[model samples]
Target: MITDPVNRFIEALHCFPALPRVFNPWFSVDPEHDASSLAPTHRIDNLSRYLTERLGRAKVILIAEAPGYQGCHFSGIPMTSERILLGQLTHKGIYPGDVLSGEVTRCSRTDGPVGRRGAKEPTATVVWQAIKTAGLDPRECVLWNAFAFHPFDTDMLTNRKPSSDELRDGLPMLHQLLELFPDAQRVAIGKVSKGILDKLDIPTSAELRHPANGGITAFRTGFAEYVGRL
Candidate 1:
């Protein structure tokens, strides 16, 4: 069981157990443009705290196919890259001066997101856009991925699909998360992840369109219909 407290897992994770042989682009963040975007420096706890503190009581929970290159896997944010966070801040009415508030815990160092070079999670631009497009808010839904940690197949940094075993292994954590939110509904993106929902006994609607494909269009059109049912 991969049920260790998120922080314990980070401590136990070998320094680059499966680290990349060379620096990968997915791990790099241009801070000038990226803002606070930096790679995850074994900061799973930072993300776990953020999720619990801000969205623990959300009504809907989004389950992405897998962790993204610059966002979840690298930056330790569930879906918070600088671009995404900045947007989230603006959308939530937060400002640059507000970052130091008691709302979010500050992070230190970048995790070798792609080998030792480090990597950042997806920008808030992408994450916030997806959430806005979905028509959700902090009170409306929570965010998550099937795999808590990032996974990759090659040094090229291509995001890999979660395998059957990977999904199965993550089942416990998913269950634990759902149990934390009583009103939460599930939104599984990608066919592979949709199947995991039922297998984990988390009831949800049909599989959502993978964001990379044309699912975004169908999602927009059907968003009203789904919310109405809610």
Candidate 2:
């Protein structure tokens, strides 16, 4: 049985059936095809352990829509991609190898070229950059998604917006996170996230634009405003 709250949280995510065919960083492993798929759990677990140590400290919770195929689907950390997983981001404390051994192969996307070592997702880059630009310490915040799992299109390579039913299923895990960090101020990172929070009756400190498509500038501006208020 998992005793620690952090591990238990991971366990809860592992058990949730957000989609019929899902890639769970906490439990699923594809050794032959992509061993790196197995590394996200370790990366996320290390992050949880760090957050556990910072319990009672003033923190912020940033909730986004859901994991992107090139982001949390592999890194297991929201607002992060494989580049961040390999310690390429300014915040290296959440590296996948921090708690696990062996080299993690950088898996290529279905539409991407092969042999890529550190691929980056545009959204991840923008989110992290916005966080840094806002003068917020990455360690002082916890990032998650309203829908914790990746929802793909028929191609399974392309990302699709999660359905209402899927988002509803993910509510329990979000609630579990809130139970663990009751004092942390919550911030929804997009319309979907804010809508879900509203449905759950969970109050938030702010709602920032999501840094995707052409919303990078708006995202940065909104994040800066939120940070300025802090």
Candidate 3:
């Protein structure tokens, strides 16, 4: 039996209904491309440790749109990449130590075209950089997404926006996280997240541009402003 609330939350991800073209990193493994049959289990362990470390300490929660193929789809941690988890990337003291705790293994094969170092997501780097730019401790913020799973239209490797139905489907887990950090201020990382948070009447402290699709500069500015207001 899972005793830890964080572990139970990690396990709850496996309960999400299997959707076509959607990938659940904690439950599903790509037969043709993943590292091994145990990749999903490894991801589950990694995320469990991450949330366990930050449970009641997070002061802010950053809600983004959804997990991208290059990020959480393999790492099992939202807005984080395997390379960053593995201590291969760093900037201004984020990641490696503050963002992730315990061991993090790559769910994707090292021999693939992404190379032996594993995939790195630019969005992950930019988001962490924004936190540092805002002069906030990375550990004080929890990175999440409206849709926790990776949704793709045709290719599992390519990222696509989650539909309204998908967003609604993800609410139970989203609410679960909020409950786990009841006092943390919610910050939407893009229009989609802000729209959903607004519609649900969930009070949000700030809404910043998503650091993807060429919005890094704007996101940094908004993040800094949000921190300044704190």
Candidate 4:
């Protein structure tokens, strides 16, 4: 019996629709990107363990627009990358302990687009930094995405905004996540995420600019003010 909230949440994620050009990190396997045949299972384990460690400790739910190829596509955790999970990259005050109790592994092929372990998303780095600046432990915050999958065009390496219809596929999992962390304050990281949250009647504590595309400074400023309150 999957009675654990984190386990149940992961089970729901496994049942998500397999949309075209959209990669479900917790289930999808890309020979071109994955390091081995077990990469998909590894991703699921990563997410399950991550959520398990933070269960009942989350104070905020940071919802971003969508997963990026260099970010959640490899890490399983939203707004996070392999480098950060593997302890290759660490922020000052955030993640002082092992992200997954020393179980983190590289799921991306070494020769993949970003090369080496896996590509690191600038936005992921900034998000962690913002958390550190807020003086909050990483476990106190749960990072999620409006569209939990990586949406792309013809090229798997590139990222694209998910259409409304595609975003609908993420609704079930999103609702499940909110239900899992009902007490945590919701914070939207971009306009798209904020719009979705607003339309769904989900109250959000803050709607800050995304740290990508030259919005670093603005995002840092906005995130500090909003997340600081929590």
Clashes of each: 18, 0, 0, 0
lDDT accuracy of residue 122 in candidate 1: 30
Question: Candidate 3 — which residues are off by over 4 angstroms?
Answer: 91-94
The root-mean-square deviation over C-alpha atoms between each candidate and the true structure, in angstroms, is 7.0, 4.1, 1.8, 1.8
The numbered model that scores best in lDDT is 3
lDDT of 4 by residue, 1-230 (tens): 88888888898887787888998888878778889878878889888877887888999999988988888888888888787877667544435254566666689888867678467878888888888777777788889988788998887788999888887767888888889888999999888889988876778988899777788999999878876566
- The full ranking of all candidates by TM-score, starting with the best, is 4, 3, 2, 1
Give model 2's TM-score versus the native structure: 0.81
The order of the candidates by lDDT, greatest first, is 3, 4, 2, 1
- Where model 1 places Cα greater than 4 Å from the true spot, the runs are 1-42, 86-127, 133-135
Score every model by TM-score: 0.63, 0.81, 0.92, 0.93
Q: What are the per-residue Cα lDDT tens digits for candidate 1 across 102-154? A: 34323323342332223434333343455565555544656677765566666
- Model 3 backbone overlap count: 0
Give a tens-digit lDDT track for model 2, residues 17-104. Answer: 6366555555555343244554555555645664575457547888988777677665566777777656665462344443233454
